[model samples]
Target: MPYSEPNSATLTPTAIFGGMFNPPHFGHLHPLQDALNLLSLNKLALMPCHIPPHKVTPEVSTEHRLAMLALLCAEDRRFCIEDIEIRSNKTSYTVETLKQLKKRTQSPLWLFMGTDSFNSLRSWHQWQSLIQLCNIFVLKRGREALLHFPEISEYMDCSAKKPLNEAQLLSLHTQTGKVVALETKLLNVSSTQIRNEIRTRNESEAKISEALLPESVLNYIHKHHLYES
Candidate 1:
C-alpha cells in the first residue's frame, strides 16, 4: 500500500518514534521508513527528547537536534517532528508522552522501539504503564524470542506464537498493552560512531557521506560547527 500523510478523517493506526536524535541518521531513519511502509501507518511522529533517562545526556542542544530532525522530515511527508519533550524542560519518559497522546487522539497507538530499549523497559520510569498506553512494536534483525526477558514475560503474548513475522504483524490487531516483536533490516550505525567520525575527519574527507548522515544534515553540522568539542 502506498504511504499517506496522517489525517483525522480516518482513525487509522498511528505510531511514535522518540529518541534524543542528537544527530538523526540512517540508523534512525531506515527502521522508521521501513515500519511506515510495512505497516501502512497513517503517519509517524518523530519525537526528540530533551534528556534521555537511560543514556548519557546528549552533548548537543535540543535546538540543534530538532533542527537536524527538521531537515530530515523536510524530505518525507510521512514523518512529522514533535518537540514536546524538548519543550518540557525535564527528564524524558515514554509513559508521559503516551499519556499526552492518549488524551488527544482516539486512534490506535503504536510505539516503535529497538530490542535494546524493549529489553530495558522495566528500568524506565513507570514502565509497566507503557503497555497500558500503546502497543509496542520492537524491531529486531534476528528471530529473537520476545519471551526471553523474564522481567516483562507477563506482558508478552506467548499464545500468539514466536518470532512474529511481517505478515502476522501487518494483519495483527492493535491491542493496548500487547507486545509484538518485529524483524526488520536496520542500519548498524550509531550517533556515537557518526560523532567520532566527524570529529576525527576534516571537511576534505568525504568518508561520512549522505549514507551515514543526510546531505542537508551534514551541511547543517558544518554550518553550525557542531560536535567540535
Candidate 2:
C-alpha cells in the first residue's frame, strides 16, 4: 500500500486520470505526480469533467477549469489536460469517458480514483462494467477513517472470483483487469476551500490571486463571478 506503483514498468502503458478540476489545486497535482512516478505512464490525460452529475455547485465553468488545468500542467510534458469531456454536451460519466479513452490509446488504461470514490463505486452509473474495461488505481485520500467502507465490493463485476485486494492490483501485468491501491499522504487542499475563502472574504482572493490559474481562465472567472455569483 506504499506509494510505489504496482505496474509502472510495463511497455508504455497509459493511465487515464480524469476529474472535475473546478480549480486544480495541490491535491490534484499529487496524484498526477504520484501516478506518473508509480505507473508506466506513456501519457496522462487530465481530462476535466464537463458536467459532473453529483457536484453541488455545478463547478466553475468548463472553460475556466480547462484553462486553469492547462496552465498548471503546461510545463510537464507527461501530464496533459484534454477537452474530451468538455467537448461533449452530454453529462460526463466515467464509463463513457473510459471507453472513449480506450479507443484513443493503444496502451493499457488504468483509471485513477481516490479511496472515497472507490468506496462509493456502487453509486456510479453503470458501476459494474466500468471496472472491467480498465484496471483501477485508487489513491488513499485523506486519513483512512476508523470505519471500514466496503462499498467497492458491490461494484457490478465484483464477485468471489475476483477479490479486491493487493494481488488484484498487481495482476494488471497479465490480466490487465484489476484494481490497485496506492497509499500517499494527502495535501489537505481543495478547490471548494479556495472558493469558500473567496466567497467569505475579499482578502483571500488577493492572497492566492497571483496568476494561480491560466490567464484566460482567470479572465473568464472574473467575467462570470462563478463562486461569488
Candidate 3:
C-alpha cells in the first residue's frame, strides 16, 4: 500500500510519531500534541507499524488499528494517519520509513519517540543512518532518568531548550545528526496493561476511563472483541 505523495510545494515542517498503537490511547496523543506545539510543527503524522521489530507483534489486526487511529485523527485537523508501514506488510523499520517519507517531501521531518525507546536505539537496524534522514525528538516524562549511552550521548544537542521558539526549531530542523530531548507530561499508561485489563475484567469491572482511551476506540474494542480470549 503505497502512500500518496503530498504536494511538496505547499509542505510545512512535519513530525512523525511511529508506534504500534495496538489500540490508540491518550498516552500517545497527549505528548504528541505537546510536541506539535513546542516544536511549532505544522502537522503531525501518526505512523502505525505493520510489524514492530522491538516488541511482540500486536494482537490487534492492522485494519482495526488503522480504523482506531482514523477515529483519533478525525478529531484534529493537524493530525494525519500514515499507513505506509502497514501497507508494506513487512517489518517496519524507522530508518526505512523515514527514507521513504523524505523522498516524498522536502519538508523537514522530525521523528518522535519516547526516552525508553531512545535508550535502546543501538538495537535498531541501521540506527546510525536514522539521524541523517530526520531530526530525532526524545520525549521524557517528568524527571525520569535518562539512560547512559556515551555513544549516543556524544551526538546529543541540548541547545534547543524546552518551550522552543519558532526560530530555534527552524534552525534545528535544517540541521540533521542531532538528538534533542524535550520534557512532556506523558500519561503513565501502557497498552500491555490495557490489554490485560480487558481480558481479565468484566465489562463493569474493566471500565476504561475516557481520559485514557477515546470513546470511539473503546467502542471499537468491544465491538470487535479484541484482547479477549
Candidate 4:
C-alpha cells in the first residue's frame, strides 16, 4: 500500500520524528509531545526507519516496531505513523526520506532529533543536503555540551531564546536551511536500557513503569516475549 499523503490545506508545518523505535516507549513519546507543543506543529509524524544507518539493525522486526508505533499513535489523533522508510525497504537515510516527503507536500517540514544524534549529523549520508531540504529541530539531552559542526553550525539560529514565541516558531517552519535547538525538559530513558532490563530481569522484577512505556505496549512486549534471548 502507498503511504497516504496529508491534505496540505489542512495541515501545515508538519514535523517528523524518525528513529529505530525498536520498542516505542514513553521516552520517545514525551519528547515528541514537547516538540509538537514547542514548535506548534499541525501534525507530528512518528516515522520508523526500515534500517538505521548509524546503529546496528534493531532486534525487533519492522513489523513489530510498526505495530508498537501504531499503539503509541492510537493515544492521540495529532500523531501520525509514517511508514515511508519501511515501504521503501532500503537502508533508510534521512535525506532521501525527506526528499520523498518534500515532493509530496507543499507544507513546511521539520525534522525532530536528539542532541546526541544531532552531534553526529556529519556522518549521515548527504547530511548537508538534508538540512537544506527542511528545518532541523534538536532536542537537548543530558548535560553534554552542544558540539558544533562547521558545516551546519554556520547556519544554526541561536536567536531562538528561551520561551519561544509563536512568531519565532512560525518563522522556523517557513524558512529552510537552519538548525534550532529547542528548549524543553527531556527524559533520560533509552531503548537499549529498556531492552537490557527486559532481557536480564524477571517480569516481576522488571516491572516496566508507565513512565517508560504505555501499558498497552508493555502488555504487547510481555505477550510477545520480545528481547528474551
Candidate 5:
C-alpha cells in the first residue's frame, strides 16, 4: 500500500496494539502482523500503557518500553508506537482509550485481541460500549484455554473462522454501528512463558530465553536485574 495522505480514503485500518510492551518480543509481533493483514489495516498504532487496569505485570519502565517499541517498529511505517496513555493517566483502560481515539483521528480503528480475551469481553471496563466504538479482531491462540473461563459467545457475537494458515485470516469492517468478530491466524507464543524463563533461567529453558526475546530486553534485565530481584 502507498503511504497514506491526508484527506483521502485510507484503507489502512489503524489497529490499536495497546499493552505494556515491556520489551516487545516476537510473540507480540505475530498477532500484530496477523491482525494488520487480517483486518486489512494499513497501519498499527502501538499503544504502550501507563498502568493496565486489568492486570499487574511489573515490566520495564513505561519510557523504556515505549522507546524499545519505537525501535522495534522503526523499520516499518505501518507500525507506529504511541505513548498517549503514559502522557495522560497512570492507569490505562481500553474503554477510555477507544473513546478518545474516536475523538482524535478519522482512520477506521479496530481492537485486536486473542480469542480468549475476546471471550472475556463483558468482564472488561465498560466493555459493551467498547464494542459499539470499534470492530473486534481476534486471533486464535490455541486449542487450550489459559484461564479456564466459561464458554462466552455473546458479548460481541463475534463470528468465528478457523484459519490454519496466514492467508485465511478472518476480516470484518463496521462504520455505522454494531460489533463484528473477525477471525485470523493464531500465533503460538505466550508472554507468561517469556516472563517465567527470565525469572527461572533453567538450562532447559536457556534456548527460549536466548531466542524469543530481543537483545535489548535481555540487556534491560541485566541492567535493572528485574527477574533477579
Candidate 6:
C-alpha cells in the first residue's frame, strides 16, 4: 500500500538518523552535526533499532544501547532518542518506521543515509515505499560523484543539475520521493572496529579514552562492561 501523509498548514523540517547504534560514537555524531547545521533543522531524531535487518546481531543489549544514546541526548539539545523500533522488538524496516512518523507528526521527513546504504537500498524490504513516505539525503563522504546504481537514477532529481545551490537543495524537503546527495565529512570509524578494540585491549586498561567516542558514552560502557566478551 502507498502511504501518504495528510496535508498540514504547518510543518517542521525533521530528519531521522537510524541505526543499530550498538554504541553511538563520533562517526555517527559528526555527520549528524553537519546535517543539523546545513539544514538548520528544528529536530533530528536518533533512532536505535532492536534488530537491524542487514547487520549481524548487536554485541550489547537493547537496554545498554538506548542508555548510551540517552547519554548522547543529554550532551546535545538538538538531538533526541526515538525508540519505536527498539520497542517493536522486531525487524527494523525503514518504510514502516517512516509511516509511523508521518502518523505522529506532519513534519517534512528527511531520511539521512550513508552512500553504502543508499547503494544497497534496493535490497531493503519495501524499499520503494521508503522514498514515497519521505525524502532521502545521501551523505557522501568523498568528492566522487554519487553512485548511479541500477534503478536508482529515476529517483534522483536529475533535472536540478549537479552541485545544487543551497536553495535548490533545501527545496527538496518540500516534496517527497526525491533522492539528493549531500557532501559531508564522515569519521572513518565503525562500531565493529570499536568492539574489536575493546575486546582485544589489555584488561587492566579497559578504559577507552579514544576521541572517536564521547566521554559520557565511554563511562556508560565501562560501567556496564559492554563489548568485553
Against the reference, the lDDT scores of all candidates come to 0.71, 0.62, 0.75, 0.75, 0.60, 0.74
lDDT of 3 by residue, 1-229 (tens): 1112244324566678988888888888887777776766658889999888878888778889899999888767789988889889778999999889888878877788999888888888998787667667887777666665544423343322457765555555566655777777759887777777778866664676455788888888889999887
Off by over 4 Å in 4: 1-11, 153-163
- What would the TM-scores of all predictions be? 0.82, 0.73, 0.86, 0.86, 0.72, 0.84
Runs off by more than 4 Å, candidate 2: 1-11, 40-42, 56-59, 141-170, 204-226
Compute the lDDT for candidate 5.
0.60
On a 0 to 100 scale, what is the lDDT of residue 145 in model 5? 38
In model 4, what are the clashing residue pairs, if there are any?
none
For model 3, the run of ten residues with the poorest summed lDDT: 1-10
| Candidate 2 structure lDDT | 0.62
TM-score of 2: 0.73
- What candidate 3 gets wrong by more than 4 Å, as runs, is 1-11, 148-162
Query: What are the per-residue Cα lDDT tens digits for candidate 4 across 1-229?
Result: 1122345334477679998887888888776676666665647899998877778998788888888889988777789898899998788989999999988878777888888888888888998888777778887654545677655533343322344576665556456666777655667788887788887876564675455888888778878989878
Off by over 4 Å in 5: 1-11, 57-59, 75-77, 142-187, 202-204
Q: Taking the tens digit of each residue's C-alpha lDDT, what string does model 1 give over 19-55?
A: 8787998788777666665565647888988877878
- Name the candidate, 4 or 6, with the larger lDDT value: 4
Per residue, candidate 2 scores C-alpha lDDT tens digits across 176-203 of 4456666555666667776675566465
Model 3, residue 184: displacement in angstroms? 1.0
Per-residue CA lDDT of model 5 for 45-98, tens digit only, reads: 878878777778555666667666776676456788776788885567888888
What value does the lDDT take at residue 143 in candidate 6? 57
Report lDDT (Cα) of residue 186, candidate 5. 55
